[model samples]
Target: MMKNWLAAGAIALTAGMTTTVAQAQSTMIPGENVGLATGAPLPEGIYAINTFIYRSQDTAAADTAINIPILVWATPFVPFGGRIEFVVAPPTVFTFSRVAGGRDTSINVGTFVGGLWAFDLGGNVGVSFLFGSYLNELNAGRGGGLNILASNTYRAGAAISYTGDGYNLTANLTYQFYDTPGRFDGPNGIPAFFGPVGISDALNIDLTATKKFGKFEIGAVGYGTVNLDPNILVFPAGLGVAPGRLGRGGRFALGGLIGYDFGPFSVQAYVARDVVTTGPRGVESTDGFFRIVAPLYTPAAAPAPMPAPLVRKY
Candidate 1:
């Protein structure tokens, strides 16, 4: 049947594209910490963060390199009782053994303006909503696969968290609308099989559960993405490829995180592996990452009142 053929083609196309864009486009977003919700905005303050991501794979000869340094500032409250935040992340990437060319490194930047609304329901439960966009930044090169900067896109999401005596649970869902970045149209280029393929919208989800032990917290994190549209439509009107395909670009991963809090600063380390595939198949990636966050400026904590001097009854 025609449907079966389209499904087959979609899988093949996704496999090919995976090697090309694996690094530049990912299920994870910058400024988002493992086991943390993207929709949960930070308290009013300026913050600086460094995220180092190291990834390894079996199929390709080269590994992926990603380093992101970011600065975020959030306002106390906005007109609608929500917080407005801005983020700037400059990421450096290195792609190994690329197909279009060879190996290369590129530096890119991602900027976002977002609003977050968080409300407490009851019993230590809270929910949040986030809406933002990644404005014009450098798109990934055709061959390189280790880019961490998001392609030009808009995203919105919501999150919910529940805290108990010594444990916490958090989950979030987000949707992305990608802008069409034209494909390389040349001999042995991507356009031959599918001309100017337009990317479908995607949905991303993450969940985390942690148990707190004084200043140290340990948690498990899981995340994945699914393309909403079933097919990659051909653009520019000349490619022979049809519009129907299975769109098997979905991917899932699981990881663990350990974090330590230091009053005004925090550090977290995480390790993750692809659950569905190894290599040359579904999304193949094994990544270890760490993040450091510190407050740039914040109001000093109110000092405790002097203990009432014991009254001498005599």
Candidate 2:
């Protein structure tokens, strides 16, 4: 029964931690394909689809997560210029966890919806503002305590990007505010055994730098997250679980990416290592991700050619 308890405790901790991690996972911008200005709106009447397949191994807990998220980007027929865009991502997750000498698995679904406004600052520079939220009510495996979705949370952020002759740079910053869900019930659906839990607000940052090479681009990506209140409370915490095991501290990752553009379509692959972990109890994961992006609209018109150079008269 020790194995059962280990699985149960792991599940309980996962439930509390999923809120922040899920929100961050849903907000990922597919920058490997589009670059760092993920918040930039598409042109009017343009639509694009992004599909991601991610696999992560959590070494600390001996757990593995396979996540697939699909996002749709669209610019509706608004009176304003194509400066406004909407995004919706629906994510499905599967996790394989080792419990004592055996393993258990669970599946869940989550949703994120948001909008962004992009503005061209001229000189190959652009900026965007975004607002969005994650809704965790649709998950089905929470009772198992191994779900990968989080509760309700709101997010807002901004991104800035620059494009030069052969390189691109981008940075994005965001803040997430979490809501109190009161407590979590374990596999037995008993709160008295599993105990109450809470989540703290978090701040996150993402940075990318890529160099263009004909149709291919190579880049480095880095991201980090820190809880706003490091001393947040997790009830019944002395049960051998770490104090910040429920998403209360800082986590960071760094990776590299390669992408190729095929006219209106693009594909990118990336691998990342969790450099700074949240502690021995928190997850230390190595992640691999693949993304496909395609635009479902005709290409925009090219600018008119410049007038021919004047010939000197003798």
Candidate 3:
């Protein structure tokens, strides 16, 4: 009788502890490709699709860049189960001209991203690695339709995440590299690097936080980067192909997302604005980036009960 009472007391203690853990809230980052810690019970054979799009307008000659990225994720609900996330974006299409009549006048297309892999580290801490490449440039001539960057590149990164009590926090480091310099094909004799390739191997560190209250969730992100190999903002469309003339490259963004989750599915809209920019031209509109994410898939349905109910009312 004493052992039974002791066991019952321990069970109550554990339940109280878990309840306390659930009462503390958290936040998540905004963006499709980036990992947002999911604090729910991991479901087996779960598949989800996400779409992210961002458009930034800058005062630079290239003026604007629109990025449309899609992602597909699959996870099996084992204790140490794994998850895979990847982007399915076509090349980005845009125009650039340093001078009004310099005449590189043509549309250009950049490459798409490959798949990325993530492994759950238990307790809401997930780690991920990239298994993909980005094109250097693509042909955007008369017959061109969404060409990729020719100087394809590769990337890898690591992240630590924690999700509990309606709150989520994530810190990550990403390394991106391209083998070639100022090598890209553009429209009508226009050089691929006409604008900012923003390339040249760099390490990016980012932090994100999110909190959920009832049906509404809100969050913010902080990002920083260090150029391992500093080179001029390579623009294939330039005349002298000058290096070191371009301004420094570093940036900070402040953004938030407000959304509601219904059962196993949810939808969110977000806006991120650059508070500080390290582009060659200081705070040029050409580099002002903003993105929106939408749902690409609905979750699975609840399972049906067995033939008989577990408990009889009689």
Candidate 4:
């Protein structure tokens, strides 16, 4: 029963995690999947997960606003009785900066595709693992787009869930694989002498613990991101350092979540603010997030045969 209940939150975390934080772009957006069991295996069906997220800026200069439309298909080809899932996401990015009078431009950053394998470990516990890639992403400040990273990044993530007695506890994390020797993803890649102009490796962790009361659910959620490498801002060749870097930078935030399930669909929302910032606190904005998870296509129910006509002969 508990494992069945956790399915409501088995919402997988997709790539396209393009958002600005601590003055850097991350491979996976932090704190976007709070209060959900992102580690559990979803049932067989085509599903959609839409997320609206923003970083609040007082002046709206170089603010972060994103809308991600993620499509997931949980395939019926259960391997070893586990679920296999595939995902695709095409995200929209908005520029809300006031250079002269600010502009609201929606830019096509790129697309994200990945696959997942989830296993049910019995005892209301499940584990999900995934590997995905972010493709066609232009280098930051290049290709007339808003992306900050010039190198296409790859990510490996996992989610572990434990549900019991109407409780949902999950830990999810993603590690990014990338290197910015020179502007890599931009058209006509920039020379390495331009200096290392992008971010180094990093990791994101989101933790959730919540309990359901009938149809209402409430919990406390926390998220943190850390840069495994600890360089610093991009500098010119005079300094002999990369053009820029955000190594050794980390941020952590905590917030609350309240959501309700409407049988066929479910919704969850949460707000978290930076509690600890390790490196530079360039933009410490309070973040707001709203998410919707629902099945987009389900197998049609088998129809019952028409009863034999009146039996008039009898």
Backbone clashes, each candidate:
2, 0, 29, 10
Per-residue lDDT tens digits for candidate 1, residues 1-314, read 11111111100000001222322233234214444434334556676677677766756666665666766666666545545655555455555554556655443434444545655465756566666655534444232222212246566777776665655577777777656553544322222333343555666666777777877878898866666765544233454433344344566679898877776666778788778631123446777778766767755777999999888876
Q: Write the per-residue lDDT of candidate 4 for residues 1-314, one digit (tens) a residue.
A: 22343553444476545455344446667876567777778777788878888776544466666787888888888888789888888777666665676566665655778888888888878888888876644534352332244456787888898877777899988888764433423223211224324456778898999888888889989998777767644443543443445657777889888878787777778888878766654445578888777777866767999888775664
Residue 204, model 4, lDDT: 86
Local accuracy of candidate 3 as per-residue lDDT tens digits, 161-262: 666566657666656666554323433232322333434455565666877787666787565544454454443345355444333455555666555655
State in Å the error of residue 41, model 2: 3.5
What's the TM-score of each model vs. the native?
A: 0.71, 0.73, 0.61, 0.81
lDDT of 2 by residue, 1-314 (tens): 11111111100001112322322222232222224345344444444444343445454333444343434344454334436666665554445545576554544444667777666566756666677776665543242342223356577777766665656677777776755443455422211224354556667777777777877878888877766655445534643555444344556778898877676566667777778756224556666666555545535778999999999999
On TM-score, the candidate that comes out on top is 4
Ranking by TM-score: 4, 2, 1, 3
lDDT, candidates in the order shown: 0.52, 0.50, 0.40, 0.68
Provide the RMSD of all predictions against the true structure, rounded to 1 decimal.
Answer: 10.7, 10.6, 13.0, 5.7
